[model samples]
Target: MEIDYSHIKVIGFDADDTLWVNETYFREAEEEVGKLLSHYETPNKIDQELYKMELKNLGTYGYGVKGFVLSMIELAVELSNGKVSNSIISDILNIGKRMLNKPIELLEGVEEVLKTLSKDYRLILATKGDLLDQERKLEKSGLIDYFHHIEVLSEKQEYNYSRLLKHLDIKPSEFLMVGNSLKSDILPLINIGSEAIHVPFHTTWQHEKVSENETNGVDYKTVYSLLEILKFFKNN
Candidate 1:
């Protein structure tokens, strides 16, 4: 689909995978937890247990570190045949705490791209995350100044996107959503009569990855890298 960048006055972006290495860190922590739990059960068994607990937590507490950490604790208890001790749970909680302490690494050349894009468009970060964790990440990333608005929602449903557009007083046709998640970022925007740009990431969170392409009748586009978006802006 052809895009006239000039018409897109407001551009919204998904934060976690788009701006920083979010899922990779989570995956690393999970691997560590798996090793710890492997003493009680095989690696495959540990993974299966964790996956089941994760799904159960998603239904109960939704997304974010709290849910993930709790799932780890619950899985440990189950895998250890109810022999899990407070020390094991404390160690698991410490691992989750250390995740927030992990340094935020901006994707390759992402800062430069955002700096250039902000000059020409109204950039607003529309991220779905745990409120406090998301806020701390933005503060640490040092990219907060580039956004005119930042939203941390429980989920990125079409309704939330519509409400955001309404709050910003921007037309659907005049807005654009850019991010890595096909489920959270791309589909919602396309369904709402807005333009969407899908930026694929290598290590997508299992919950956020789209299983199939559903942009057949939607006004959507994809680019290999975030820097490639600069091609749309003309020389001034």
Candidate 2:
């Protein structure tokens, strides 16, 4: 697993967990909804059921508050035995919209690292989520200026890695994917012959978190923080 860092021309990054504190915001919103629904169902029951719907909906509908909102509405209706009104569903949608409009917070040193990495790499954002939602987040984050290109996709499956590379007119072996989710970001790129750098986060959404054993290739490595990536590159 020799990496001539010089050969790496384009670096793709995951947006949510990798660049900013996205999951915590979502979790907070979900908790609020869970509390609101607790009189009808247990908190654990509401959370578990909604999460199950979310996982399935993501496969069909994709990331963003839309699917999550819908799942919450569906779960509420189910838990309430048809007693949940359209007003509750509408309320959930409004809440999801508000969550998207919330302020953005970049992880520590994210701007610093992006500023540094922007100088040497052809940095591209390769995040998957609702297009408009992701775009709004990027616009407000003040970090969009550092990237050369931005991709908002439905998922980061293996074909997605190839599609993004081809779209950029780069070879798979010449690209690098840096992200927090091993399941979504690291392994898919590695499968296609690209290298990956994993910068772990502490409070990942259950859907986004990956077990360490999920690292598919021998070439993959994890850093405790994003800044450690620079040291790794310098040493390598």
Candidate 3:
């Protein structure tokens, strides 16, 4: 099937792993947490149980470093049978704080791609996470001015995108989303009749992983890097 870009007037970009280094930090934090909880369980079991706890707490905590940190603390409590030490919990808190304070490291070609695309299309930042955390990264990124709109969504389902497009008065055919997650970025946009481009990151959160069969019939393009998207747009 052919994919079209001529009708795309508004282009949405996903933050976090799509634009900068994110999942890597989360992985590092998880490793530290595993070691901190090593007295209670093996590293493998810690990871597995942590993932399960994340799923359970997703509704209450939502996505972001804060949620992840809370999950780590919860897992520590559970694995230790309420015998978790205050120092270990404090260390976990420090991990989350460090993540929140980490510098925003943009991926290669990100600014160049944004610069080129902004000149041709109405660019928007449509990432999901804790609002303040996302805002902090965007501010630090120095790429905020390149976008005409900024939206930090709580979720990225088809309906969420649909509501967003409607709010912005953008037609599905006129919208395009670029991101690293197939589940949140590609599938939702395709299902809502919008175009999407997938730029996979080296590290992905387990929650965002999707089976090949799940994306079998999805209409989207997968590119190796953000720069490749520049070739897809037509010159006005």
Best candidate according to TM-score: 3
Q: How many backbone clashes does candidate 3 have?
A: 0
Better of 2 and 3 by lDDT: 3
Per-residue lDDT tens digits of candidate 1, residues 116-216?
98988889999986888999999999999999999887778899899989998989888888899988998888788888888888887777766555655
TM-score of each: 0.92, 0.91, 0.97
What is residue 130's positional error in candidate 1, in angstroms? 1.0
By lDDT, the best candidate is 3
CA deviation > 4 Å runs, candidate 3: 1-3, 234-236
**Per-residue lDDT of 54 in model 1:** 85
What's the candidate order when arranged by decreasing lDDT? 3, 1, 2
1-236, model 2: which lDDT tens digit per residue? Answer: 64457778777789987888778777887888888788798888878888898887777778887777878887888889989877777778878888878788888788888888888788999998889989999999998899999999878889987987887898998888899988888888888999899888787778766665675335787888888777745633
True-structure lDDT of candidate 1: 0.84
Kindly give the stretch of ten consecutive residues in candidate 3 with the minimal lDDT sum.
Answer: 1-10
Between candidates 1 and 2, the lDDT winner: 1
Clashing pairs in 1: none
Over 1-236, each residue of candidate 3 has an lDDT whose tens digit, in order, gives 54558788999999988899999999999899999999999999999999999999999999999999999999999999999999999999999999999999999899999999888789999999899999999999999999999999999999899999999999998999999999999999998899999999999999999999999977789999999988787454
Relative to the true structure, candidate 1 has a C-alpha RMSD (angstroms) of 1.9
